[model samples]
Target: MDHVRNANPFTSQSSYSRGSVLAWRIVTPVSWLILVITSIYYSATKPHEGKYSRHTIWGQNSHRHTPFALNSVIASLYWIALYILQVPYLSSLFKEDNTLPLTLASHFTAHNLLTFGFIHLWCRSYFWWALLLVIINWFNLTFAYFRYPKTPRVTHVAIIAGPLAWAFVSLYWDGAAAVHSHHTAARIVANVFLWTWLVYGAFYIVAFKDWAMGFALSILAAALGVGQFFTAIIALQWIFAFTIMAVLFVASLPVAAPGVFGGDVFKRGEVVSEDRERAPLLAEP
Candidate 1:
């Protein structure tokens, strides 16, 4: 069965053990729920006495403002949206006919747990440890993303593209905070590092036809530009951010071009009415 084939990538007929599948079903959701609770608790109780809370860290970073720091409000919205979208996508993976691959199932559980750890460390000013957890989580998500098919729609946006874009951007932001590097030379270095997003967005769009990634990167760039505009109204950083955002947004449009524009989902529009009529019959008894 296709379900068995997909659930265990080892072979078409191979399937994960009942106990293994049961554990994934239970542990994955539990891990995510734990993360959600802890995130809320931290956000609500931030600036805790005697601790360098998340807000404190951000405020310190803002005082020494790096080019990579994004608008906190926009970042919050992105996280909220990503968390909501992940629910539907995660549910789909466990559908009767769509069992998730073992690796992906493991990733869902481990990534959430690691992210929780990152938040805990980050709030306490353990910048180096937080960065390590984020890097590990990013690697797991990226590898699992490309290894599997981009289907069920939400996977592209929530599971990999959205989180991955944020994580990639966070590396620069968090690294700047970690080193407390806020000098002119450090700012110049940060500006140079920003181009990696453009390069990354373009390559994925061209090679993987990954419009979701392009869109995510565009939004992050726009947020960065907005934050920089307020931080230093006369600087070139905002200009660069807006320019990168515009280019990425325009290029990500779902045009008629094959692969480079609209992916298979859009191309499916080319299917004739005859095929639509035949699809129902193919399922008939």
Candidate 2:
């Protein structure tokens, strides 16, 4: 698969492997490893600095304690709005006529507003969340790429390259086809990117790993699975996806437990050297 350089410009080298360009073609468990590591490290270290941290609602001790709170609230609002709209209970509401509920329109409006606004905000922060979205979408493309028998390595590369190419075209070159959308295409693309990641992520867990990884994967899968049921009932896939994304996003808040907190390193206060001059003199002597 075509590899994009690591998004962090400060990195000395890119994280992608040049030799195994087609490595992303297969939906191996390892594909999720990068995200798992990134999420865990962010949680454990609670680093105050970095692009990802900036967009995060929560941070180390001083900042917000619950990073995922905003996401959770938003997700809950979306679901509640759908329920009030009665989109899910449409069949029962209009048994004989089978007319669609007015609530469906409201649900769609709210879903688009939330998603578009979130993406715009996330992009401004240059947070890893946006990049993660892209990566998840690419993972889906990879699955499609490998579905064929004897898939050519170049084909795999093309699949990986597609998004990068689109990103470039959208951002820099201003390709007309990529743009000029009424936001429908953009919404669909974003959903595909997200759901693909969740689906492949589930498959990856089953294909490789033990209990711990399996358990984590199961939780993630369960979230999506529950979300899917709601979508089927309400015909609100975007809303369902957005709600699940919010829950997953909130659940990933970074928290340092006991000895794990970075603050412990500075518990007593900053250590000071009392004999700095004497040490220098002794060294010279």
Q: What is the lDDT of residue 251 in candidate 1?
A: 74
lDDT of 1 by residue, 12-54 (tens): 2125566766777788788888988887776655546535545
Worst 10 residues of 1 by lDDT: 275-284
Flag regions of model 2 displaced more than 4 Å: 1-70, 73-124, 128-182, 209-211, 217-235, 238-285
Candidate 2's residue-wise lDDT over 44-134, tens digit each?
Answer: 4433554533433213211321111122233234333333332223222223211111112222223223333324334234434444444
How big is the positional error of residue 126 in model 1, measured in Å on the Cα after superposition? Answer: 1.0
Clashing residue pairs for model 2: 1-21, 1-22
TM-score for predicted model 1 compared with the true structure: 0.81
| Clash number for candidate 2 | 2
Could you tally the backbone clashes for each prediction?
0, 2
